[model samples]
Target: GVLAQAIPARSHPPSARSPRMFAWPEKRGIASTVIRSADTWQARSPLIPHEAFRWLHSELRLALENFDPSVPGQEWQGKAMSEWLREYYLESIHHHHDAEEDVYNPWLAALGAEVPPSIASDHRELVATIEVCLGLAKSLVGGDASAASSLKRELAGMMDVLEVHFDMEDEYYSRVLVDFNVTQAEEGAAVGRINQDMGLEGCRVLLPMVVYAMYAWGGPEVVEQFKGNVPPPVWATLESDWLDDFFCNNLRVIRRLQGRAEPELAEGA
Candidate 1:
């Protein structure tokens, strides 16, 4: 419900209506459609694009820690975490795919019919993998550690699948950027560019929010690898007001579930 509402249909409004000229290109007694590029006008926004990973990462880490032997809440906690994983599955990952489907796929399809089809097929495959993960999630909730572990093993198998998926996406984006001269715009350069480029921004934004979200959900090394990119001022800002808002508003939910609170901040927030 909350997740359903979280992903709005349009992050930004389109510039104009469809034109008959672009819609139906003419050849010698033949007609074709010219699919315009999926202009990522809102896609490149600062806060929202990164927010999904942040939310999912935090939630999933809490779920994993729920599996900890020392964790107090037991099956009850596991059940709650299971619900969260499912919510995140539907919200973060699924919603993201929908964006690709609606925007990226159509544009790529315009490039060639096969392109979108191949890309669309991956959605189904990912759904299948998620189904397996869901089964593991259920077992974990039911207190079936063995079953859950088996599912996790299978889920781990999909890591290669997922990585390849991301790789394909990166390739797709790279190609699109080249087409549009938007490689620089595709990713915000000059701002945390080094960390992301060299993979060092992790060190720059090492607050609990960044750590559990980017590192834990994605991978520890994803952030650890980015150890230097976060500029001092950015880090200072994150440490202060941004962090202050995150914890002040959300710490209780995370803490009650055995997550570390905002006990440590790099400096301020």
Candidate 2:
């Protein structure tokens, strides 16, 4: 039941094959690369460009609110709530930061002969935080109530730190990286490497979930940018009829939680 248990619908697609891909195509002029063999299929790596980060920021903000216990179980369960936090904050978020450390930081370091101390310090801090969060996830999973409570507290602290961290990133991106004329091709190449490293199936599944979360947060402009950058083949399954319907419905639920369509902020929004 671990697999079937209360895992949140993956915010991005994971490596799994969805039935929707079988019938859906042409929805976005990105249907030519349909994955015919799920077994041999590999997934694309998740790379968050500057715009993608902003989109994620929006989505996470909404997700935290909606997943908070103040909202009812009819919306999203406690286990799923915890899983969502673990998946995004613990896994995805850390990986994204690691990407920066691996790729962008090195580039900066090479240019300057030394990486900025502030950035280095931030990376160390993030490493420490990720370690603590990994433990917290384990504790929560182990059913330690006191640990869970403490973990939640730490999680909240991490969230606060994350807001600032992401803010710093946004500032840096606008001030410095934006001037580099970083192209989608360059980023895509990096993403391709990451994806190949992650394997095709893994990439396929995770990218969609993260992409959806970004869209749920960043709105249409971000989505367009995402589509523009991602290879056409990577999205063949996601653009299918079933997934389209599914993702839309999922968005509505997210909106309800985040108070998107409402005249005012809805439930958690």
Candidate 3:
């Protein structure tokens, strides 16, 4: 599968008609009506990396420990998922930085908050490491057996930097919306801009990754609320199409590989 594509074990809410995600929503005017509870969803975008990075921190360390990539039939699925996950982790970091520098930071400044130079510094350091990890991932995904161990160790070392940057951004980057009382609609507009920036690739990739990865921290309802923020054509079937296809068909093996049990997905049950 392409690295450009990827959500939820909680259940797929039955849509009378499941929408296909062939295109993103056309850009349009956002209603100026103030949105209540916007800050939570506002924080959700940047915080995705916060949660995803933390989760990947452990999963990356566990990838090699749990399964042997060299085994052809026995461990192939695990090997593939591990490789896909590595790529997914890298994508999350890249998108997180894009959101921060392009959207989140300006809002922070608008609110009279200055993003510390160290945050960008940390990003440069993290992104540089991420580039190296992505290379390792490209090799591992390409079936280079040796790449797994190297990628694992690099990620382990990267965690110290990731955790520090996350905490720093919590104080400086993500929290600024609430700190300044940014309205939900206002924050939503910002998210829309991000959605616009993310455009097609984000629709196929980051959207599902965030929704599913979010389950680690926020669970199903959180996914629902987060869905409201996702602007649509994709949103119409975000769960039913992109998310389910990404998770159930593609990522289901990961649960088995990780030694966790998942219910068989019964459509319309």
lDDT of 3 by residue, 43-162 (tens): 564565566566555555554456556776644643565556554557767877877788877766776876788877877888888889778767765677777668768877887777
RMSD of 1: 16.9
> Which residue runs does candidate 3 get wrong by more than 4 Å?
1-49, 70-83, 141-145, 256-269
* Selected candidate, larger TM-score, 1 vs 3: 3
Which of the numbered candidates is closest to the native, going by highest lDDT?
3
Each prediction's TM-score against the native? 0.46, 0.58, 0.70
User: Please, what is the whole-model Cα lDDT of each candidate in the order they appear?
Assistant: 0.44, 0.48, 0.59
Worst-scoring 10-residue span by lDDT in model 1: 23-32
Q: Order of all candidates by TM-score, from best down to worst?
A: 3, 2, 1
Choose 2 or 3, whichever is better by TM-score.
3
RMSD of 2: 11.4
lDDT of 2 by residue, 40-92 (tens): 10111122333333344455567555444433443243444455455534665
* Top-down lDDT ranking: 3, 2, 1
